[model samples]
Every structure is written in structure tokens, then in C-alpha cells.
Target: MERFAALYEALDATTSTLEKVRAMEAYFRSAPPEDAAWGLYFLTGRKLRRLVGGGALRTWAAALTGLPAWLVEESHTSVGDVAETVALLLDTAGIGGTAEATTSLTTWARDRLPRLGQLDETERQALMVSWWRELPTRQVFLLNKLVTGSLRVGVSATLVARALAGVAGLPVAVVTHRLMGDWTPSETLLPTLIAPGETAAEVARPYPFYLASPIDGDPAQGVIGALDAFVAEWKWDGIRAQIVRRRGETFVWSRGEELMTDRFPELLVAATALPDGTVLDGEILAWQGDRPMPFAVLQTRIGRKKVSARELTAAPISFLAYDLLERDGVDWRERPLHERQAELARLVEAVPSPRIARSEPAVAGLRVDEHGVDRVRVELPLPPVAALAADAVGRLAPLE
Candidate 1:
């Protein structure tokens, strides 16, 4: 795909480090590798560009400059630290805000990697680390994560899959299902999949199938009331995650593609506690009793290499599922939201089983009829606050 080669050209173009990061992000999203080796390249490039533009990579630079590599590794290998490292790197560089920095890095990385695709994992890691050494130790760690492909910014797989499908001129549904198996697909597939009319970013739908672009101001302020198309979910202020129980094994991945079940033992236990052979859409929330704990409380539970027993006990996480993506070899994404919700509910409560969420009825319809069968669709309503069944207000919270 020209996208891979295009990104490589962008990295070497060196308009700015922000451009490098942006290019790198696109590369990682599509490159298709995530092991420690790949992680090295991704993280290394990430930190260098981030540090250069001024972010968390700076603190690492400040503390670890010319310091031994061992100490730096300890601080930055973990996911949580890696993210803060980005912000810190920018800060160190005297860079401000993500917009300017990310854009600069995106373009720079585009110019940095000339033969990026041709390099093997070890060579890629070495090249990234050496290049990062030009920065500082903290930045090194950040770059380590990047070179290794561990720059996790909560980008969703479905988003990349959509992008890939768009490039391929195939239905997004088909692309998404192709990735529904044990292995995650690479970001490089995107340009390969790009249909002639679409852009790479267009491939990813924040909320796919059913679409809702962000709006300005509070959505409750008459925004919902004006929409002829749209639906609203509380947008649960928690980690966006997917629960896939396939081949009798359950995997819980944050939207960024990090397999995070171990960090919240309760979640893994809770998820495995449900039915087998299914995929679910939900938020992993910090809970005490039935109500959700504040987003602050949940924050401690995310992005960890290991969760202590103490942490697990104090901040328990729960999967508040909303829809089912798969069941028994079926791809349910094309199914209406209502039916998907029902199937998701079935995963938790069919016959006798544990339930992660209750089925809340949502309107589903045919967006376009084809081949004599009606396609199920998600209906987004006008907003202010989301209402149910068109006119109901107080009892409803989404579908406005």
C-alpha cells in the first residue's frame, strides 16, 4: 500500500517532529506488529518526537539524561507511565499542547523512516533506540515504547479496521469480522484497504455502524432536539473495551488494543463469569456497590503491567456491556443496535447465566433495503438529553 510507503516518506520529510508522531501513529495503527520488538520501534519513535516537541519525554530526559539505560527502562516500560511520558516529553521540550506537537511529530516521523518497512524487528528497535539516544533517557523510554509499537492512545481497533476496509473498498462489516479472531490486524492494512473516495481517518468511526460526530457544548443543551439522525449513550466515562470469549478463552482489550484483563482481576473474573463464544461492547468502570464510582476512582485501575491485590480490592472494575458483536461464528455488527443489545444480553442472561448488563430496548430499522431483506440500523434521535421511544423523557437517558 502506498500508505506505508507514504508514511515512510512523511517521516523522512522532517517538516517537524509533530508530523513524525502523526505519521508514526498512522504507521503503528496499520503496521500489524505489537510484540516487544515492534513495541521498541513504536515507543522509541514516539518518545523522541514527543520529547522534541516538548512533553512527558522531557521529565525522562531531565532525570535520565546520560544515565544508565536500566533505570530508564524500569520507569517507562509500563503503559500508564508511557502515556504520561508523552505529555512529559512535550513539557520538557518546552512544547505546549497536543495539537501543535502531534502535528509536528506526525510530519517529522514521516520523514524519519525511509526504509521502515524493509527493516526486521531487531534492526528496527536498534535503529529507533539509537535515534532516540539523540534525545534523553526519559525520551528514550518513550521512544522505546514507540519503536516497539506500544504507543497506546486509546485508538480503537474497529476504527483502524474501518479505515482499512475503506481503503480496500470492502464493507466495514467485512473488515471488522476479519479481525474478530485471535490475532489483531495491523495498521498498514488501512491504505491497502482505502477505497478511492475515502481518507484514512474516515475509516475509523468513533462509534461505528451507528455514527455520531462530536458536537460543541453540552449535548443536553437542545442539541439532541435538533437532530433528525443521532443517538446518545452516556459515553460512560470509563475505559472503552471489548470482551471476546472465543475458543473458550476470554480476552478483554481496551480500545487501544491492550489486553487489560489482568489489571482488573475482577473484570476478568467478571467477564469469564459470563457465557462463552461471544464479543461484547462495554465500558470498564470503577464500581462500588451498583453505582459507578467517579472517573477519578477508575483512573487508577487503567494501564498497568501488574495490579496488586490491594489495588484490585480497593478499586474493583466492572464491564458495563451495551452490545454484542459476535456469537457462535456470527458477526452481529450489521445487526440493529436493539438486536445486538439483545444478543449481548443473551451472553450474560440466556437460560441461567451471569449478566454484565441489562437489555435496554433501542429502536432499530432498515437504513437501506437490498436483496429483498431489510438491514437493521441504529437510529439516532434529536438531543438535549437522550429520550427513548421517540417521546419518553425522564425515564430515558440515550437515543435522543
Candidate 2:
């Protein structure tokens, strides 16, 4: 707990990326592997669900300090964060003596936090008070944040992966891939995650997505050259997903790195048609006939543990595959976009489902001025009109 608290303070105090990475690397090197595993889990944005509510926590804190409930409420309002307020009140009131904490991050998470959920209110309160008396103010703040499940400390998962990669002497891409999907912090898993060799079971993890920069202004005026170089497709308003079929198993991952295998059952059924060791980058849309339904319709299915037959029928989903990242266990990311698209087209054509298809191309608008300069413009059907600059569009090798 003390080591984690110091590391957290170091990370929280700095805005420099290099400093943050160094801090993380140093902590990973010195801390126990078990505690380091939990540290990585929490610092990399995996949070436990809220174990205690604000009202209950505040009441308990007030009881511990022998302070009036209204005074605690007023302090909370002034602090604007219940966790910080409690930490401050406890610190100033000196309710808990200067005792030190001997618990490690793993012990606190695996043994203490889980038990809080099972205990009756009185037992839970007593346990929390005892913890407060033993732990320092900084740790109390962190514990409160953990109990409330609101521990956002302004660090990106990418940075965390980069630090781990540096520590393990592995590629950032490898670390990033290993971090994806459902993973728990375990002694064995942590070592495997940082290990150099690739394992057969890790095939379901998705690669980091390639995102495009938004283009602004008139497509014709913005682009300096002819429009033939770029291929234009409708950017569908839907969830961007990567579908992986490896070792006779299919996994669906959202761009946010969530493994959403069960929510969209129909997509999983359709994915069976894909060949093993294939990874497709696509958009998951709520479809009605040939066109996509509004995004609101798709929101109903998000985060659902189970999709009923009626709900599946109502919000029938389809995957518009746009890029092929892998084929037959081979990485295709370094290949040009056109080549990737060609393979994706072939794969989609082989699938028998109407729900799955290639993204439709938009008609390119072209014009020649009296000065004899060729100008090209493409307009999308959706709002926040997207136009591709001719020079930028031409840079992408058009799929044959």
C-alpha cells in the first residue's frame, strides 16, 4: 500500500510523459510482482465497481470522527469531492493516530475490498474505521476512490503499455496486444503478459486500431491533385469493432478494448463464416434492410450481458468490414490500404450473410476549371459532411 501510494503520487504530480513512464518502470522494477500486477491493473484504468455509496461512506466517516453529520455534508460540498473531503476531515481532526499500513495492494484488493461487499452495514463500517486509523491520509483518499470506483488519474492505457514494454524489453505493439481483452491481475498472468514469446491462446486479442484524421473544408479546394488516388467510403455512424476468428474461436472487440462476445449474438453467428486466423476491422451497425438505423437503436444493445431473441430480431446488426488486419495468422497491417481492402472484399464476398458486407463507396464528384486544373470532391450522405482532400485522398493507394 505504501509503495503504491508513493507511485500514485509520483504519477499524479507529473504532466510529463517521460517522467510518468519512468515512475511506472521504476515501480514495476522494485515492487513485488503481486502488488505490481494490481498496480498495473488499477493504474491502467481497470476499476472495480463501486463497493460503497457516498451517503453510507460519509455517515461512517462522520461517525469515526465524532463529527456532526451536517458538518461532514458541508465539508463535502466545500471540497466538491466526497473522497477528498473525508480524507481532509480525517487528517485535520486527527481522528486516526499516526499508525502505519502494512497491507500490500494485492492483499487490500483481493482480501479486504471483496469482503466489504459481503459484510453487514455495522461490520463494514467497523472494518472501514479500522482501516482509516491504520492508513495515512493519502492512502485513505486512494481507498475512498477505490471504494467508490472513481479512480481516474489522467493516464492513458497507451502510456502504461509503453512503460511496460520498456520494462520488459518488448515491442510496444506486443504489450498493447497483450493488454487487450478480458484479463485479471494474477501472478502467472502478469509474467506471461510481459513474457517475450507469443502463446497460442493469445490469438483472440485485437491489434491497436488505426484512426484517421478528420478533413475539413471543400474537398476540391483542399486537395492539390487529382482525386483518383483515394477511395471514398461512407463512414458509418456505428460502433467500430474488430472481429477475430482464431483457433476455431471468434472474438468481437469494441474500439474501447472491451470483449463484447455475448452482447451481439447475431454477429458471432455470422462470424462463423469467416476463416480461422482472420482479423477484420469493421463497423457494427444496427441495420434494417440495406441501410443502417440510427445510433440510438444500437445503444439499446450496448453493455447487455445477454441479448434475447426478440431484442436481437428488433436490432438486427451487421458488420461492414473495411480492412483486413490479418489473414491465415499473418499480419497485414503493413500492407497498403488497397491490398487490405481487396482481401477484405474477398472475405466478405465469401460470407453468405446479407448482414455482413463491404462498405459502400461514395461517388466522387469531379470538375475541371478554365485553368485546366482537375478538382475532385466527394460528399457523404451523413451529417457533419466529410470531404476528402484530393492530395490526401490520392495518397491512399486505391483498391483495384
Candidate 3:
């Protein structure tokens, strides 16, 4: 726990990317694999759901520190953070004690945190107070934040992946693929996660999504003179999702790295129509007949563990596949956009389902005059009416 706290402080104190990566790499090399796994879990921005409410935590801290409840509340407000406020108050109250007995991060997380849920409020409070007395100030702040599920550091998942890759002597992409999907921190899984090769077990993982930069200036200046090098599609106002079909199983992941397989059963059923080892990058939108419903309609299904039959019929979701990331266990991200777009069109056409369809393509509008100067124009189709507006939307790129 103390080592993890020091790593957190080192990461927080620096803005240099190289320094952060070095600190993370050093910690990964020295810490036990079990302890490092928990550290990786937290450092990657994954947090346990709030097991205890903020009010209860504040009250408990106030009682332990012998401070008035109102004073604690005021300190929290002044600090703009509840965890830091409680730590500061406790530290100033002179509740120091020797760190004679030590606990590992793995033991505290795997064995201790879960037991708190089974205990009564009195028992929980006593255990928390004991922890406060024994742990250092840094660990105390971290513990408070962890209990409320509000811990946040400046480090990003990308940096963490890079550090792990450095420590394991593997490519960053391999490390990234291993980190995807659901897996618990254990002695067995840790070795497999850092290994150089893929695990034999069936796992559905998503490829890293390629993102486009926002247009800042004139749209024409953003594109090269070539008129047949790019493909354009509607920027749908829906959840950006990746549908993965691998090893005779289908998985759906949102842009936020959430595995939403059970949330949309209809999509999973539709995925069975696709071939095994096919991966798609697309948008999930609510549709009725040939038209798309508002994003608000899809919001009702988000975060749901199970969707009722009536709700399924009412919303009626479909996937608007835009690009093909993988086909038959082979990655196609290095291929040109036009080639991928053609393959995507073919795949969508073969599916033949109302629940899955291809996104509308942007056709190039061009003309040639007597002067022999080639002129190019692009057309974008609007929603609901689906009419082409020649002068409204700016061109992203010319289609091949």
C-alpha cells in the first residue's frame, strides 16, 4: 500500500510523459505481480463502484478525528474534495500511530474491502478508524477516495499500457489487446496477461478505434487536391460502438470501453447473422422502418442489465456499420479507407437483416468545363428527408 501511494505521488507530481512512464515501469518491475495487478487496475481508471455513501464516510471520519461534524463539512467544502479534507483533518488531530503491522494492496483489495459490505455500520466504522490510525497520510487519502469510488490521477491508460509493455518486453499493441475485456487480477491471469502470445481461451476483444481530427479551418484546405482518395459517411448522433464476432461468439463495446453485451439483446441476435471472426466499427441507433429515431430513444436502453420484450419492440435498435476493422481473424486497419469501405458494403449486403444496415455514402459531385479545368463537388445527405444538400455540409474527403 505504501509503495502504491508513493507511485501515485510520483505520477501526480510530474507533467513529463517520460518521467511518468519511467516511474510506472520501475514500480511494475519491483512490485509483486498481485500487487502490481491491483495497481494497474486502479491506474487504468477502473474503480470499484461506491460501496459506502459519502455522507456515511464523512460522519465516520468526523467521529474518528474527534472533530465537529459541521467543521468537517466546512473543511470538505473549502478543499473542494471530501477525501483530502478528511485526511487533512485526521492528520492535524494528532492521531498518529506506529506502522508496526503492514498490509499489502492485494490483501486489502481482494480480502478486506469485500468483507466491509457484510459488516454492520458499527463494525465498519471501527475497522475504518483502525486503518486511518495505522496508514500514512497518502494512503489514508487514497483509502478514503477508494471507499467512495472517486479516485482519479492524471495518468492515462495509454501511458500505463506503454509502461507495462516496456516492463514485459512486448509490443504496445499486444499489451493493449491483453488489457481489453473482463479479467480479474490473480496469480494465474497476471502471467497470461503479460505473456508474449495470445491466450488459448476464447476472448472477444476490440481493436483500437481510429479517430478523425476535427476540422478547424476551411474544409477545402483540410483535403488534398485529389478527388478520389477518401470516403465520407454521416456522423450519426448515436453511441459509437464496435461489434466483434470471434470464436463463435459476439461482443459489443462502446467507445467508453464498456462491455455492453447484455444491454442490447437484439444486436447480439443480429450479430449471429455475421460470419465468425468479423469485426465492425459502427453506430448503434434506434430505428423504425427506414428512418432513425432520436438519440433520446436509445438513452432508455443504456446501462440496463436486461431489456424487456416490450422495451425491445418499442426501441428496435440496429447497427449502422461504417468501416470494417477485421475480417476472418485478420486485421485490416492498415488498408486504405476505400478498400475497407467496399468490404464493409459487401459484408452488410450479405447480412440481409432489418436490424443491420450500411451507413449512407457521400457521393462525389463533379463537373468538367470547356477550359479543361477539372472541378470537384461533394454532396451530403440530410436526415429525415434524406435530401442531398450541395452547398451546406463541407467535404471531408473525396471518395475513390
Candidate 4:
């Protein structure tokens, strides 16, 4: 816990990318695998969800420090962070406990943290106060931030991947892909990540998603050069997901890297139509007949452990696939967009489920010149970010 707090401080204190990478590499190299697993989990932007809320933290901090509720509120307002405010107040009280400087990051994250979420309010307060008194103010701040799900170190995923790649002597792409999909903190995670060749993770692991960047608006308005060189599609307002059908099993991974196979069971049924070694990158939208439902309707299905029949009927879901990332066990991410899209169209046509459909390029206003070259100076609604085969959106190379 103390070591993690120090690492957090080191990362937070840095504006230099090189410094942050060095700090992370040092921590990964020295920390125990179990501890490193948890560190990687947090550093990769995963969090302990629904553990504790700000209101409860504020109330508990006020009670623990013997400070008035109003003072706690004022301090929180001034500090602009609940975790730091609570930690500062608790530190001034000079509380003490036996666990100070002894508990490991693994022990805190794997053993204590989850238990904290399950306790009643009284038990939670008691346990948190004991921990508060034991840990130094900095660690207490980290604990509070973890509990509240507000721990932000301002490091990009790319930087973290670079650091891990440096530590393991692996390519950044390999490290990033290994980090994608659903994973939990464990002793084997670090070894598996740094492992030389293919391992069990490859059986179900998803490719690192080709993400989009924000652009001002319409690329056709001289923002980007020629339109015929690009194929434009609607940026669907839905969850960006990778559906992997490998080894006769289906895995649905959100862009956030959550394995939500169980969240949308309809997709699972639809996935049966897909062949093994097939992976599709697309959007999952709540659908009603031919059109999509309000995104708000889709929100109802997220994070659900089980979908009741009534709920499934009320908000049916569909995967509007746009890219074929893999087919027949071959990685197609290196192929041209048109080539992948051509294959994707064929696969969508072959699939019998309405739950899966293709997001086709908008061709309403396309024109061809007298020389028979396609003149595509169409208006786009937004500054488009495209997922080039080998690159992320907006960081595009010309279509081959």
C-alpha cells in the first residue's frame, strides 16, 4: 500500500512522459507479481466500482477526526477532492493503528478492499477509521480515492503500455493487446503479459481496439484532403465493442475492456451464427425493429448480471458491425479498410441473425467524374475519426 502510494505520488508529480514511464517501469520491475498486477490494473484505468460514495466518506471523515460536518464540507470544497480532504483532516488528528507501513498493496486490494464494500455502514466506518489511523496521510488519500473511484494520475494508456513494454522487452503493440479484454489482478498476470509466445490469454483475449480521436467537424470541408480516398460511415452513438468468436466460444468486450458477454445475452445467441476465429469490431446499440432505440434505453441493459425475459424484450440489442478484425484465425488488421470492409459485408450477409448487421459507408451524394474516377465530395455531419488497419482513428495513413 505504501509503495503504491509512493508510485502514485511519483506519477502525479510528473509532467514529463519519460519520467512517468521510468517511474512505472521501476515499480513494475521491483513489485511482487501480485502487487504489480493490482498496480497495472489501476494504472490501466480500471477501478473498484461501487465500493463507497463521496457522501459516506465525508460523513465518516467528519466523525473520525472529531471535526464538525460543516468544516469537513468546507475543507472538501476548498480542497476540491474528497479523498485529499479526508486524509488531511485525519492526519491532523494524529490517529494511529498497528497496520501502518505493514500491509502490502495486494493485501489491501485483494483482501481488504472488496470486504469493505460488503460491510454495513457502521462496520464500514469502523474498518475505514482503523485503516485511516494506520496508514500515512498519503496512503489514506490513495485508499479514499480508490474507494470513491476518483483516482486519476493523468497518464495515458499509451505511456503505461510503453513502460510495460520496456520492462518486459516486448513490443508496445503486444503489451497493449495483452492488456486488452477482461482480466483480473493475480500473480500470473504479469508473467503471462511478459510471456514469450502464445499463452492461454490468446484464446479469448481481444485485439487492442483502434480508437477514434476528436475532430472539429466535417472532413470534406478541406479539413482532410480528398473524399474519394475515404469511405465515410455514421459514428454510431453506441458502445464500441469487439465480439470475438474463438475456440467455439464468444467473448464480448467493450472499448473500455470490460468482458460484457453476459451483459447482453442476445449477442451471445447472435454470435452462434459466426464462425470460429471470427472477430468483429462494431457498435452495440439497443434496437427496435430496423431502427435503434434511445441510448438511454441501452443503458438499462448495461452492468446487469442477468437479463429477465421482459427486460430483453423491452430493449433488444444488436451489433452493428463495421470491421472484420479477424477471420478464420487470421488477423486482418493489417489489411486495407476496403478489403476488410468487403469481407465484413460478406460475413454479415452470411449471418442469418438480425441481431448482427453492417454499418455501410454513406454513399447518398457520391458522384463520378467524366474520366470514371469517383468524385466523393459529400458533406459529413462531424469531423470523422477512422480506424485505419494499423493505426488509431484520426492518426490515419491513406487507404491502400
lDDT of each: 0.48, 0.79, 0.76, 0.82
**1-400: candidate 4 lDDT, tens digit per residue:** 8878899999989899999999999999999999999999999888887688998999988877789999999998999999988888887888644335768889988888999878898998898888887788788899999888898777888999999999989988788888887788999999999888777888788888765553455544554444456675656778999899999999999988888999888889889889999999999999888678888999999868799999999989999997888999988877777888888999999888899999877555455566553344445442233423222231244221
CA lDDT for candidate 1? 0.48
lDDT by residue (tens digit), candidate 3, 1-400: 7778889889989999999999999998888889888888888888877767778878988888888999889888899988888778888987645444357888888887787788888888888888888887878888888888898978987898899899889888778767876667776665677777677643587866544444334435533333343344566777888899998899998887779989988888888888888989888998888878888999988868899988898888989987788888887766766677778888888886767788866443444335443343444444311111122222222222
Best candidate (score: lDDT): 4
Please list the residue runs of candidate 2 whose C-alpha ends up more than 4 Å from where it truly belongs after superposition. 67-74, 97-100, 210-230, 262-266, 294-314, 365-400
Better of 2 and 3 by lDDT: 2
- Candidate 2: worst-modelled 10 consecutive residues by lDDT: 391-400
Give each model's clash number.
Answer: 93, 0, 0, 2
TM-score to native of every candidate shown: 0.45, 0.83, 0.82, 0.80
Ranking by lDDT: 4, 2, 3, 1
Model 1 poorest ten-residue lDDT run = 382-391
Candidate 2 lands at a TM-score of 0.83
